[model samples]
Target: MMDTMFLKAALAVYFVSVLGYVTSIYVRRVMVAKVSTWIFFLAFLCHTISFIFRYLETGHTPVISIYETLSFFAWAMAGVYLAFQPKTKTRVLGAFVSPVTFLLMIAASKGLEGYVSIPEVLKSNLVPLHVILSVTGEALFALASFAGAMYLIQEGLIKNKKVSGFSRMLPSLSDLDRINHFCLMWGFPLLTLGVLVGSLWARTAWGSHWQWDPKQVWTLVAWVFYALLLHQRLAIGWKGHKAAFLSLLAFAILLVSLVAINLFFVTAHSFI
Candidate 1:
């Protein structure tokens, strides 16, 4: 009950914060953006309280079920956005982030609304660590691709000399590009670590590190795609459009691995 109450409260405040952000974008006001930012922070704090209560109720990490996992995933997305928003001069990004966060939370709250006890076989410590790390990495990639997409739109508007209020509200190309780059730079290593931990867990549970399950195989594919993004960004000095488009593509593949595999394929991950 506390979980549901707090979660609903957080969602309500978060929606207000999103409205503030959208209004700021349309009105082109820094003060409104700043207010929206603080509102977002408040919403995050409320969400954290819900998570805390959920954990106390469950006696374990509040990430076992799909909805719970998605909730945490949304939290990570907001956390990362909060961490850099002040410095990025990209308050306009709230236009994207707020909706995404709100949608994920909505999805999380739409399920059976009952606690799912963890299976005995999934009680391994590695399970929690793997989920947290993988979720965090995916959150980062999600932001990166969003930034990349924003970059393309802004770039197009600029090239066509569609200089107007909307164009002005968009973050500069350099800022968006930097966000895309920064997220990718960090996301890949985190994802790699998650994959490694997952493999370790697999070996412990099934006596085999490589199962070639749909989740495993597609995870490998996403990993390779991100690795290519990193290589192109670092080793090949790719930046701007090339990096942005590739990050977007990598994120799309990540969605397939995460959502498609879970829904369509019978894998060890789905079992968990």
Candidate 2:
């Protein structure tokens, strides 16, 4: 109940922050964006508190249900964005990030009834490591897609010579590209490690490292796709529009597959 209260508080603050960021974009006001970033940080703090309380209440990692998974994914997205702000000129990115965070929180809110009992197999210590790494990596991929989408918008505006005050508010193409590059550089390895850890857990619990379950199969597919994308990025000199387009494409496929796998088929990952 306490965690629910904190989650609701965070959601309300996230909504406000989303409004602030969107307002900053239209108003072309840097100060408004800065204030919105601070507001977003406050929301992140509230989300962190909520997660901690949920973990305490559940007596395990709070990622056992769809509600908790969405909550943690949103939290990871916020954290990843905030972490990048200090190192990059990404203040305007909150305009893209906040709306997604708010939507995820809204989805999470809808699924917040009933406590999920953790299965005995999921009680292993590796569960937290695997989930955190995989989810955080996915959060990074989400950011990369956001940046890619923004990059396309900025590119279109520039290419068509549609110079306007609104266009000026966006981050530079180079900056967006760098963010994409950074996320891919790190996200791939984290996701790879997550899959490896998950396999180890499978061995411990299911007596096999590879089950060929639909979730596992789809995850491998996503991993391979990103792996190739990352290779193209690092070795084949992929950047700019081509890289941005591929990033968006990859994430779109992954997102669609994730939803389809969860909804249309049964898998070990159905707990989320």
Candidate 3:
């Protein structure tokens, strides 16, 4: 109950942050965006507190249900974006990030009354490690996609000779590409490790290293997709538009697969 209360509080604060970010973009005020970042941080702190309370109540990581998964994913998105702020010039990127986080929080709210019991197979400590690592990696990819989307918008404006005031408000194309590169470099390895850990857990729980379940198969597909993107990025010296486009493509496929797997197909991972 306390967790729920805190979650509601976080959601409210996140909404305000979203409004602040959008307002900053429209008004072209860096100061407002900076203030929004602080508000977003406050919301993240509340979200963190909510998770702690949920863990205390659940006696495990609170990622066992659709409600928890969406909440955790939203938290990861906000955390990853905030983490990047100090090292990068991405303050305006919150215009993209906040809305996505708010939507996730809203979706999470819809499932709040439908919390499912964790299956015995998911009780292993690996659940937290696998879920956290994988979800965080996915969050990074989400950031990459956002950056790529921004890059595309900025690129289009530049190419069309439509460099207006709004285009000027966006982060530099080079900076967006760098964020894309950084996220790809880091997200792939984290996701690989997460898959390996999940496989180990699967071996113990289901007596196999790999299951041909739709979820597993699709996850592998997504992994290989990113792996290829990373390989192209490093080996072939891909950057800028090409890299940004592929990152958006990969993330799009991954997002579609994730929803399809969880909603349309039955699998070991459907507990979420």
Cα deviation at 181, candidate 3, in Å, is 0.5
Error of 3 at 122 (Å): 1.4
Clashing residue pairs, candidate 3? none
For model 2, residues 44-149, the per-residue Cα lDDT tens digits are: 9999998898888878888767677888889999999999898987899899899999999999988775577777778888988888888899889999999999
Cα lDDT tens digits, model 1, 150-176, are 999999899899978478888889999
lDDT of 3 by residue, 81-166 (tens): 99889898789889999999999999997876524677877888897898888888888999999999999999999999989756
lDDT of each structure? 0.87, 0.88, 0.88
Give the TM-score of each candidate.
0.96, 0.95, 0.96
**How many Å off is the CA of 147 in candidate 2?**
0.4
CA lDDT, candidate 2, residue 74: 95
